[model samples]
Target: MYHAESFAAMGWETYIVGYKGAKLIPSLLQVPHVRELYLPQPPAFIANLPRLLFLLWAPYKILFQALTVLSTLLGELPYAPEFILVQNPPSIPTLALVQLCARLTGSKLVIDWHNLGYSILALRLGASNPVVGLAKMFEKTFGRKAYAHLFVTHAMKGVLVRDWKLLGIKAVLHDRPPSHFHACEPTEIHDLFSRLDLRPAGEDFLPPSSPPLSTPFTRLRDLPPSSLSPAFAATLPDRREDRPALVVSSTSWTADEDFAVLLNAMAFYEKRARAVNSPPKENPQKGDKHDRLPKMLVIVTGKGPLREKFTQDIDECQKLWQWVRCVPMWLEAADYPLLLGSADLGVSLHLSSSKLDLPMKIVDMFGCGLPVCALGFDCLSELVGEGNGRVFKDAGGLAAECETVLKGFPHAPELEKLKQGLVLQKSPTAGEKWNTWAEEWDRVVKPIVTHRPGVE
Candidate 1:
C-alpha cells in the first residue's frame, strides 16, 4: 500500500494486483483511484491443510492464480505498464508468470527482494532439501533478469552481490511510517485514547503527573484501561491522576520471535519491584520515597499460534506480581497507531529470518517516539543505540534492562535521553520518501523500458 501510494504521488497511474485474503485487501478495495486485480482465494480446507500438503499444493495454486491475475491485467490495462514491481518469496511460479507477462507487454520488471524463496522454505524443510535448492535456482535466474532491484537493507544487497552475483541499479529503501505517526503531543495522545475508547468518554482528564525525585512514585497508579474492546471501558478500574508507564510489543506469534524472553524479563522486573517496594526487615526504610516502585502496564498485541500458550504464561506471571498486568489481543489497523502513541516504551523480540531485513515494527515504534528494547540482529545497531534504545542478548539481560528503566520511575535520566534521541532523528515523511524513491527508480528504469524493440 505504501509503495502504491508513493508511485501515485509520483504521477504514475497505479494499479494493485494481489490475492483476496491479503491483510489489507479490504482497505485497498475502498480506494477509488487504485485499480485492483484479485485472484480467487483458496478454500478454508485447502488453506488449513497440514504444512507439507500445503507446500505441495502451493505451486499449482500459485500457477492458477497467476493466470487469473495476468488475464485481469491484460484486460484492464489500456496500455502496457511501464513498470511491474513484484514482491519476492512466493518466487517460483509467480515470478515465472510475471516474467512471461512482462515479456508479452514489453513492461520493465523490478523485483523487490524481501527474502529469498528458499530461506522461507528452509525453515520448515531443511536447507539440504532438493526443493530448497530448486527454489534458490529459480530465484537466481529470475532475479538476475530484472531491470532493477530494491532491497530493504544493505546486508541483503551484499548477500545477493556476493552469493548470487546479481548486479544492477540496486537501492536500499528502509521502511518508514507516515508523518502523522511521529512524536505525538500529550493532548493528541489523550484525544486518541478517548477516540479509541481506551479511556472513559466524558470523565475529567488528568495529564500524567510528574515523577518526584524524593518519594516513592506511588502516584503512577492510573494506567490505560484494559479491555479487548473499547465498550468494556466502563468495567475498568477508575481513572487516576497519574498513569503507569505503558510497555507494548506487537508480534506474529511465529518462531522468529522469542516471546519467552519477554515473559522472563517481566518476571525478573516483578521480582525487582517486590524487593524495592518492601525493604529489608533489618533497616526498614519506612518513610523513604526513593524506595517506592513504579507500576507497569504491558500490552502485547497481535494474535498467532502461540497466543494461547503465551496467554497462559502471562496469567501465571500476573498471579505472582499484582503490580503488573499484561494483555494480548489482535488490534485493528485503525487502533494500532493510537495504541503505539499511548505507549511509553516498546519491546521487540523479532529475530529476522535473514540478517539483512530490519524489524519494521521497531521503525514504527521509533516513528511514534516510543523507545524500544530490541533483540540484537545484524545491522540492528544502525537503528538502535545507547540513547534511543538498548539491544540485549538474552532474556535475563532484557529483564535487567526493563528493571533498570522502571526503577528510574517517572523521570529516569536514561529514558529522557532516549526520548530526546528519537526527537533528533530526522528523515523524510513516508510520502516524501516514497515519492523521492519513485522518481529515482523511474530514472533508473525508464531507459530500459523505452529502449525495448517495439517502442518508438
Candidate 2:
C-alpha cells in the first residue's frame, strides 16, 4: 500500500506480484502504471476448511506458491528491474527469494519498513521466544544489505542512521496523505452545514438549536461541509484586521499535546495584561482590569490508550476548561476547523518519541491556514518551519512560546501569508517531492541497471 502511493507518485513503473487471480483484480492493482501478478485460487474442496486453521497455514502455502512466481519471473519478464521494492509479512521464504533475485539481477534493493517486525513478534510471543532472536537477526541482515531504506518516522530513521549506521541508505520518510478536502470556500462551508442539518449558530460551542441533518456526527463533522457550514463559521467572532487568533489544536493528549505549557502561557499573558491595567473584554469592575485577548481554543481530537496515559493532567484540563476554554476530543476533524478557523491560534502536538514518524493531522492544520505550534520532534521540525509553523523545544518549554504566540498572534498577517502561499493545499507537494526523489532513484539505480543482463 505504501509503495502503491509513494512509487507511483515518484513516477516509477511499479508492479505488484501476488496470488489470487480473480479476487485480487482491481482493488489490488489500482495504482497508476502498476501491474499485478496473480495465481489461481485453490480448489473448492481445500477452500472450505476451518478459517483459523487455513489462516495458520496461509504463509507456508504462500511460500510454496512463490517458487512458481520466481520461475515465471525468470522466464517471462523480459527485463530485470532496476530496483526491487518488497514488503515483509506475506512469506519469509518469498521475501528471501525476492532478495536473492535482486542480488542475482544486480538491482538496488529497498525495504519499505512499516514497523519493527521483531518487536511485534516479542509482544505476541514471550521475550524468550527463540524465533524472536532469529527474526531480529533476519531484519538486521536485511537492513544491512538493502541499498536504501524507507521509514515512516524519524524514530525509524534514528534506528537506521544512528543505530544501524547503514550509510548510503537513503532513508525516505512519509506519512499518510491528508484526507481529500475540497478547497475551502464560504459556500462550501454553508453547503456542508446544510448537508449535516446543523443550523447556523449565534454564539455558542454547542451545535445550532435545530436538529442536525446528519444523524451520527462522527468523522463527518470534521469535514469542510459540516465544519465550514454557515452556521458554525457565523458563530466565530468577527476577524480583527490588526491581530489574528493563535489557535492550537491536536488529537494528541496533554503529555503529548503539551497542554500544560499552553495553559501556563495563557495565564502568564492574562497576568501581564492585568499588571498593565488593560481593560477586560467584558464588563469591568472598578478595580478589575483585563486585556481584550484574542480568544484561544485548544482542541484535542482523538482518544484511547494515548489519552489514558496522561489521565492526571487531562483531568486538570477537564477541570480547567472553565478558565482555559479547551475542547477535548471533538467528534470529527471538520469540528476542529470550525472551532479553529474562528480561533486566533492552532496547535498540533505529537509525542517526542524517537519511534514516531510524523503527525499527519499537522499537515491538515497547515492546509486549514492555521499557523502551527508543533513539537520540535524529528521530521516535524524539518517538515514545518518558521514560515509554515513554529516547532517548540519540548512540552515543558512550550508554555513560554505559547504566550509569545498569543501576544503576537498573526491573526490577520498570517492569514494573508497563508493565502499568498496557498499553504493549505500543501499535500500535492508530496507528489512533487516524490517525483524529484524518483529521478534521484533512477540515478541511484542506473549503474546496477547497466551491469545487469535481461532475465532469460
Best by lDDT: 1
Error of 1 at 232 (Å): 29
Q: When superposed on Cα atoms, how far off is each prediction in RMSD?
A: 8.0, 10.6
Root-mean-square deviation of candidate 2: 10.6
lDDT of 1 by residue, 379-448 (tens): 7876688867889989899877776665555756667778777766643343333333344345443444
In candidate 1 the C-alpha lDDT for residue 349 amounts to 96
Misplaced by over 4 Å in model 2 are 6-109, 113-139, 151-183, 190-248, 251-291, 308-316, 319-323, 330-345, 355-358, 377-381, 394-397, 406-456
TM-score of 1: 0.79
Clash tally, candidates in order: 2, 22
lDDT of each: 0.68, 0.49
* Per-residue lDDT of model 2, residues 39-82, tens digit only: 44434343334545644664566556666767755655667877
For model 2 the TM-score comes to: 0.50
Model 1 lDDT, full chain set: 0.68
